[model samples]
Target: MSNPTELTHAPHRDDVGARMGMWLFLFTELLLFGGLFLVYAVYRHEYYSQFRVAALELNLSIGALNTVILLTSSLTVALSIGALQKGQKHLSVMLLLITDILALAFMVNKYFEWSTKIHHGIYPGSEHLLNLPDGQILFYGLYYIMTGLHALYIIIGLVFLTIVLGFVITGSVNKDSYVKLENAGLYWHLVDLIWIFLFPLFYLIQ
Candidate 1:
């Protein structure tokens, strides 16, 4: 593949339908996350003390760090899309690389945070649980379910972006036809937005 800098042009899609489709999908994603937030709202209110303790036990710093990582990645991806729309090929590719590294940072932090929780017997079906009260168990259960589902979705979103980033890196996207990169950025922003709410609800609310 030629160096991205060698290509000075980029392609922008003029398709109204494509843009509309992306927006519609984003709306659907918002609804899905809204449902999860509703579930958290209901459960946390029901088990306030236990949930508070659970939240305190959570790695707030990790969540905060990941939040910044994802947010910065979103900016880079947005900038990449801008570069394409502006016909700047090299800038788009470099932005994509930056976004990927940010994504990697986010995922690595999640790994360390989850592993720490696992070591403390926080995972479901763990044989060495500390045997807390029923309310605490319920708190942990909700915490795991809500956060687990969110994290799973994040992983899937990252995989989709990895594919798009590869397209950029390999020159398939190049200086033209970068619609896929923009779409991928949209999805990544959705992932970041979900975490924004999750962080406040799970950590700050307590």
Candidate 2:
């Protein structure tokens, strides 16, 4: 029979394997977004003028504010990981909570931005949108599709961070076993990286 001591010991964790799996998952996400980028490039090329006009319709202030928010959140997440690595559990948890708040702020800003667009009749398939030229119509379609997907990613990342925060609180993730927090940090960075690409694509098309 296995020793009682062995039974009580924590199970061996494959940190390397876990990290590799996360990277692979991140690569697949990149592939998915890459395809959308290609489509955007193709359509934008054909409808450059319309794309610019459509881009102008987007709220620059909100886009810029969200950019700052996500960037700040990324910094906080990185700091949280560093804090955990250095055995500062309380600081790590605090920083992570700040990151989560920033994420929620980003979502709130997005809600207002989308609300403004919809209120202005710029959403997909609305009479005003449909009445626009084909390029403009296509522009709004892609806008909704890409930005909406990005928002979904933000929500997913929030859930991951929240769960990891719980782990940190319970001492499940500490200096000796912080791969979970590190992985969560990587995922949050990916979320920020995607927005870095998306901000320019949808907001700064001029």
Candidate 3:
């Protein structure tokens, strides 16, 4: 019969496998977005002037605000993971809640930006966009597709973090077993990284 102390100290598989699997999934996501980036680069090169003109139609202030929001959210999620690792469950939950609020703020800003554009008759199939030059059309097309996809990822990350928050509250994720929160943090960071790229390409370019 095993001693009670020995039973408590029994070895189990580390979380390395779970982390590796998450990394692999993230690699696939990178490839998918990389292809889109390549396409954007090709078209931007072909229509440099038109692309610049099209980009100017976007709101720099709103884009920059959203960038800041996502970056801050990323930091919060990282802190949440750290807090969980340190056995600070209440702090971790509060951090996650802050992250969620930031994510919602981002979506709200995005909604207003898009709505303003649409109000001005600037959208995928609108006659205004259809009348623009081919390069301009391509620019707006890529802008919509890339930003929309990133927004979807943000929503997914928020949902995942919410679920992880529940797990933390229920004690499924704690100082000893918090890989779930770490994985959620990884996903949230990925979303922020994508926007980091998108921000400069779409908003900062002249």
Candidate 4:
């Protein structure tokens, strides 16, 4: 006959292991973005003057607004995790919902920015860009690629946070088992951090 106490005490999941795995995944993501930044730096150094001109075409107001939106979202997500830890389920869910809404707002702002650029005949393969000086062309090219990739990351973060919200509602990620939400928050913060780097590089540069 099996001992009931031993059966009850058996380990079901390793929260530590799960967190370690999440950190490993985040490290890989960092490496990917680091490589992209390296390319941007090399190209920008080669074409500093033209890069400044290309940057002027970007709307600093819109970029700053998006930066505020992302930073606010990061705060909400962090607060949500804190709420969940304190066993405040409703508050946690509401904070997460706000985070998701902020993410959507960021995307909307990005859409308008891109639309304006495209309307001005400024895209990756537009003849307008091609005919520009080589330095300007390279600047615009890197700008589009980096910003596009960051926007994709925001979309992905929204989807992941939505799933985590669902989990929280179902009580699967409550105070005792909040690893899922924690991991999701980590991902969102990463997206925000990348934008912090991007905003200054592409917008505030003189």
Candidate 5:
């Protein structure tokens, strides 16, 4: 049988390993987005005018509102972790719940935004899009691909946050052992960071 003392130390090692693993996973995500950004840059250089026109068709107000939502959600995640570290479990859970709400708000806003676009026949592979010039077609193509991927990431992050919230409530993550919460926070931040890049590239281009 394993020594009781050794068993006690096992979680410490596991915590370190978990953190390293999360970082590795996030690094891979960055690579994926980096490649997409490079593609966007290449195409934008060739179709700057078309890209600008397509961007103008996007609703800046909705994009800006989603940006604020994600930024606020990131803040709540940070605060949740801090609250847990300070042994305020209830407060931590509350903050995490707030983060979840903000995430859902972002998604709902995106839903409406996408619906509006699609209603106007502005989505990928639509007849209207295909009828456009090559440059304009490429612009909408990248916009959908990038923003759609970002929205998927947000959903994934929401799942992670929800799971971590349960762990926190059940004491699986606590002040003494909160590696799981930290990992979830890292993932959420990555989701937010990707959007920070996406919002500018797709919505605020000159």
Candidate 6:
């Protein structure tokens, strides 16, 4: 294996140092999420019928719409990176701005989705859900646990992206060094990936 110190000494051309560290971080993050997914799979199997029934309450169309929004945001982020590579500062910033807008839109959708469910007495351990079957309650319990954590990570990813955009706007970053953008994008893509799985698992009831 390569020496750890050797890795750090890589040339910093185009913010390569930052991106290298970010890629490594993303690998670890994926492993962590993998464990969570494993746990979810076990629980899902134990309560398959309940999960299926509970999933019907969620609007698949909304989940699908969010998926499209996240994918489009990812694409915009990609375009931003490409613009930076081409030394087109204005174009890169424009794309970043679009990303910010998309992030806000995503949060808006999430809020409405969650709130609508909450209002409909779909939340776990709520008085409103007092009449729900135990299995259905368990299904919603897992749903809240999984999706809540995912949402937290999405917020964190957005914060990181916003910080990177701030750097870009303040001239601390530029076309020659957009590794931070790439790093932030990695995190954003992870958020997107999680939601992709979440959509099918939580919204596609047989």
User: What lDDT tens digits, residue by residue, belong to model 5 across residues 1-206?
Assistant: 56454765653346778999999999999999999999999999998999998889999999999999999999999999999999999999999999999999999999999999999999889999999888889988888898899999999999999998999989978887898999999999999999988999899986
Expressed as tens digits, the lDDT of each residue in 82-123 for candidate 6 is 988898888888998898888888888889999999998778
How high is the CA lDDT of each candidate model? 0.78, 0.92, 0.92, 0.94, 0.91, 0.82
TM for candidate 6 is 0.87
Clashing pairs in 2: none
Q: State the lDDT at 4 in candidate 4.
A: 51
Q: Which residue pairs overlap in candidate 5's backbone?
A: none
Candidate 3 stretches greater than 4 Å from native: 1-11
Stretches > 4 Å off in candidate 6: 1-17
Supply every candidate's count of residue pairs whose N, Cα or C atoms clash at under 3 angstroms.
2, 0, 0, 0, 0, 0
Against the true structure, what is each candidate's TM-score? 0.84, 0.94, 0.95, 0.94, 0.94, 0.87
The regions of model 4 sitting more than 4 angstroms off are: 1-11
lDDT of 5: 0.91
- By TM-score, how accurate is candidate 1? 0.84
Q: Write the per-residue lDDT of candidate 3 for residues 113-173, one digit (tens) a residue.
A: 9999999999999999999999999999999999999999999998999999999989988
lDDT of 3: 0.92
Off by over 4 Å in 1: 1-14, 127-130, 170-176
Over 1-206, each residue of candidate 1 has an lDDT whose tens digit, in order, gives 66453475534335456767998999987888788778777877788787777678888788888888988988998998898778787888788788878878887888898899998878876665447765567666766777777778777777887898788777786555676777788888888888888778776755
TM-score of 5: 0.94
Candidate 3 clashing pairs?
Answer: none
lDDT of model 5, residue 135: 85
Cα-based lDDT at residue 107, candidate 4: 97
Candidate structures ordered by lDDT, highest first: 4, 3, 2, 5, 6, 1
